[model samples]
Structure formats: structure tokens, C-alpha cells
Target: MSINRSVENMAKGGMSMEEFKAWVRENIDADEDGKITKDELADIIRRNGEWFAGWKARKWMRSADSNRNGVVDEIEIGNLAEFVQKHFGIKIIS
Candidate 1:
């Protein structure tokens, strides 16, 4: 399924943290790798808002990349719903 379809499904009832992380990877992982880079994250944030894309992406990476590998991996993604709520101002219950 496409990312749009997955997001639509999430809006209907929400999905698990793992599912949400997969959705994020599918949408943002331009290199098709298992990890997401800071640029990819910044691009997503830029698409969402006009201000502080760099700062927000760095902050997100710092918070989400638990292993400090300079990228966010599937295992490192925790409570993505909470991240969305804090950053995009959209509350997700999953």
C-alpha cells in the first residue's frame, strides 16, 4: 500500500508504533535504506512548516535516534505518535 493509504488508515483508527514508523520510513526514506537521514527528516518538516526546519529536524533526530548513529532506524523509533503530537501539533493515539 501507499503512504497516503496508510495515513488515511491511521486517521480512521490509528496504527501501532511500529506501523507508524514504517509509514514514516516509506514516505521519507528516499535512499530506500532502513535508516532515515537528517536531510530526509528536514525535508518532511519543511513540507509541514516554513520555519525552523533545520532546527526541528536536528532536534527530532537527537531525540529519536536513541543509539546516536546520526540516523533514525526502525528500532530507534519510539512513540512516534507522541512525536507527531509534539512537533506537528497532531495527536495520534497508537
Candidate 2:
């Protein structure tokens, strides 16, 4: 599902941040590698209905990838979540 749809679902279901993070891992981690790459992040942003998905993804990746390992690993997901909330208006109940 798209990120916007997911957010709507989350809002309707009252998901916590932890649950939303898990949802990202399960749904957005297309490679199933337990990490989110820039491409994957871009895809998610694109799915969120952003016309400038690539640019937004690059910005978010740069901000969230604290380790500079070219991927957002588990530790960096919090950063990703914050960015998503701030930029996409995704509200996590917790």
C-alpha cells in the first residue's frame, strides 16, 4: 500500500510509533533485508504521492542515514520516522 494510505490506516487504527516502524519494515522494506535503501525510500515517497519523490527521498535519506552507510538501518529508523512525520504529516499515536 502507499504511504498515505498506510498513514490513513494507521490513523484509523491508532497505531503506535513502534507499530508504524514495524509496518515500514514489513511493507516498505521491499528487499526484506532489514534495512531501507535510498531507492526503497524513494519508492515509498513516490508511493506517498509526491511528484518529486527522488529529490525528497534524497533529502530524507541524507537526514536520516546517521551512519552514512547508504541505508537506513534499524537504529536510524527513528530518524526516518521523525522525517516522515514532519514532512508527510503522519501522526503516530505514541
Query: What would the TM-scores of all predictions be?
Result: 0.69, 0.80
Pick the TM-score winner: 2
lDDT of 1 by residue, 1-94 (tens): 1123336556555566667767787788888888888898788767655578788778778778878888877676663456665654443555
Q: Which residue ranges in model 1 land beyond 4 Å of their true spot?
A: 1-9, 79-82, 85-94
TM-score of candidate 1 to 2 decimals:
0.69
Report how far residue 84 has shifted in candidate 1, in Å. Answer: 2.8
lDDT string, candidate 2, 35-57, tens digits = 99889878877877768888877
